[model samples]
Target: MSSVESVEEFRAEFRGWLRAHLTGGFADLRGRGGPGREHEAFAGRLAWERHMAEHGWTCVGWPVEYGGRGASTAQQIAFHEEYALADAPARVNHIGEQLLGPTLIAHGTDEQKRRFLPPVRAVEELWCQGYSEPDAGSDLAGVRTRAALRDGRWTVDGQKTWTSLAHEAQWCFVLARTTPGSRRHAGLSYLLVPMDQPGVQVRPITQLTGTSEFNEVFFDGARTDAAHVVGAPGDGWAVAMATLGYERGVSTLGQQVGFRRELEALAALARANGALADPLIADRLTRAWTGLQAMRAAALRPGTAPSTAKLYWARWHRDLGELAMDVCGAASLTAAGVHGDPYEPDDWQRLFLFSRADTLYAGSDEIQRNIVAERILGLPKEVRA
Candidate 1:
């Protein structure tokens, strides 16, 4: 196939492969084999990761020397768009692949790359971020998690909040302070930590929705070999910022795509409940659609998009959720996916609940706007020491 034809062929062949290989519960995401089931969910997740890894999908954006397909940015984007349309679950090892893996490619030692990349590419060891602290949500630089190098090892101590997938993850790419007496942003270092060890404590945080996708992680003298540092000492802030940028920026739009889908489902629900006729809901729907479009356009930008797309998603998701709830009305009976929908049993009820986090996690909407205003807009900084 020609280059152009190859991409098109990849898409067509991929769609068929998805349909064929996606049976036994993946066919209908709402049925038996969805993210709702732990084993099945992880299985489906690993299945896709392995298939992609086999097809060189997992490491598409990585360089050829690092066992990646070395696919172009545009091709990668197209692959993601198509994957989004196919309703793939979030990669079980996104922290490994999306966050740490890339940083490793850019900054890791040769030993680190060879040791970490292949396992990450195969989804063997899941990873999570050890950022957010009880006091350092938006103000990441304020994180108090300190790591002191002792003899030939590092002793880590502190807490991390809202760490997603801590329960299932094997390791965490952590940002901890290694040098003392330096400013908040100075002297910090990034380290890869094993979650199953004795020094780490995982406490699940149940949301208002009664599900705990994120957890509070505490470390008391967590020991690590000094060899695990991602880069030079004191580079943690920059590395963390880059990771946050990737999360909010266009690099990892899988979650944003998830939000877009949730928004789409909301629209369909409005039509079914006759809420499409409600002037308020209709107006809200128009706004939501516009917001989603803007998100898509923003996410498609070539580079980091300079401007982050998180705030847009945060606003759009919360608004869309409220709109869906309103259209369902007061008489709506304990609405849920199982409650009722004009089409399939699945809809945005649970997704609406999930959207509440869109603003809070991955830096709040307030934080995203602060970033855009201060950094992108060159506005005055917020006043507070």
Candidate 2:
């Protein structure tokens, strides 16, 4: 079959599988978990993901040698788009399957890949990122998390804030200073640390959504095997940046699918509630639709910088949240309590509150602008104190 034919076939297969399986026990799980709603049906979502893994659906993008199907980029995109269209529960292993797994494939030792990839492919172990300390958030070079090599083990001591899913994760990929006096991204190492150890403590942070998807992780002399390091001791800055590249990669196509859904639903809502009659609201809705089209084009265009795409989508989503509240008018102020909990927000309210952080997380709007300015536009670097 031609490549186009193959992609279509793959899309059909995935769509078919979702239709057949997302019923009976899993019927209610549709749209159960994502963003601010990560607290919803946690056990059910995990179980559904594991069920997908059992049927060879988890890490489709990894090389076949590492237990993936060795799927091509087009095929992987098809999988994600179809998965989103099916409204499959938000994936539980995204950090493992998308970020750390690919990082290991690129920079990890043979032994490291052998030890970690299988559990990730099977969803038997969940992973979280250990970047973004309280002081170091987007300025990763200022990381004070220190790890010392001693007697075949690395002892780590530091705190990581805004660690998504840390409370539910079994492992974390940590970037820490390895040399005593090293500064500004020097002498850093990326270590794979277990989250279950006595020295590790995970405290969940309740957010505007009234849920605890992000966490504060404290590591006091946590230990990982010396072999857990991904690359050479001082090369962590490079490896960490690579992981961020993957963060802004093809999987974002899947994210855009979700964005399209939100836009469509919001439009329907406007029509039903008479918001569409307001000329300004109607104009903003039209602009959002056009922006989604541009975002999708940018995602597919070759030579498009990730920073540029990140800046656009983050701002667009944040603006969409603001528009969602405006569409709701005065009613957005009060919680509808559609869910059992009185404090539980309806979808639009939740979207508005949760997306307020869109511009802040995943490297922040200011940081992304700096990257595009300095690297892509070839502008002079910003002065630092």
Candidate 3:
């Protein structure tokens, strides 16, 4: 088939599947699980994902031999966009399908691929990332997690903070200090560790939204097989960075779709509450619509577009959250339920609270500015303390 034909076919097929499947009990799952709302209908969502896997819909971007459709880039983006448009539940295995799966395909050994890819494609094994620490959130080079090779196993010891969905994950792809004296990004190894072992402790950190999607993971002598390391030992920074690159890849097209849905819903709320009469609110809404268009265009570009895209969407979403509150008027200040559920924020409240960290997490706005400055504009590097 021609490229255009294939993309059109892929989009049509995916849209049809979503319309057919997102019905009955699953119908209620629409627009439920994403970001801070990951705890919502998790089991149902996982079941939905496994159902997608059963129908060859999961991991469409992966090679056919690796249990994927070997879909073209355009096809993948089309799938994401259609999925979001259908209001499907947020995917539970996105970490596996989007990040680690591609990283393994690039850097992992054949044995590693054989052992891991099937479960990931099957949606049977969930994964989390272990990168940020108390000392190294954005400055990932400052990671202090240590892993030592002894007796054919890598024993890890350290804390990783802000680990998304670690409590629900069965495995974690970790970047740890493998050499004792190594500093910064050197001497790190990317190891896949099991999460169910006794040495791994997961403590959920409740966010301002009253949810615990973010977690603090303590690895006290946690161990993985020596063969679990991806790429050469003491050279994991490159592999880790590659995963970060994937984090900003085509899946973001889907994210923008979700963002568009949010904007539409916020606009409806404003119209219902007469908030659109306010010129300030109206202007912000118009700017938001234009910003989304700019984000879509930037995301289609190459190179530093990912960093720029992240900055654009994060700031835009955070402002949208603020706009949501303004649209809702005084109702945004109160919880949905009565005194017993005083902390149970409404959707707009949750959005505002959760989005406060959008600019701070992943890579902070400051870090992104530095990246654009030094890498894109050839600016001098920032001095470290």
TM-score per candidate: 0.88, 0.98, 0.97
Error of 3 at 293 (Å): 0.8
lDDT of 1 by residue, 32-146 (tens): 2222223345666666677667765676667778876666656666666666677766556667877787888878899999888888888788888999899888888888899
Clashes of each: 0, 0, 0
Better of 1 and 3 by lDDT: 3
CA lDDT, candidate 1, residue 12: 74
Query: On residues 267-379, what C-alpha lDDT tens digit does candidate 3 reach at each position?
Result: 98888889999999999999999999988887777654678888989999999999998899888887886346867887788889999999998899999999999989899
Q: Pick by lDDT: which candidate is best?
A: 2
| Model 1 spans > 4 angstroms off | 1-7, 25-40, 249-257, 303-307, 331-347
**Structure candidate 2, residue pairs in collision:** none
Q: Give the C-alpha miss distance for residue 316 in model 2, angstroms.
A: 0.8
The CA lDDT at 188 in model 2 is 92
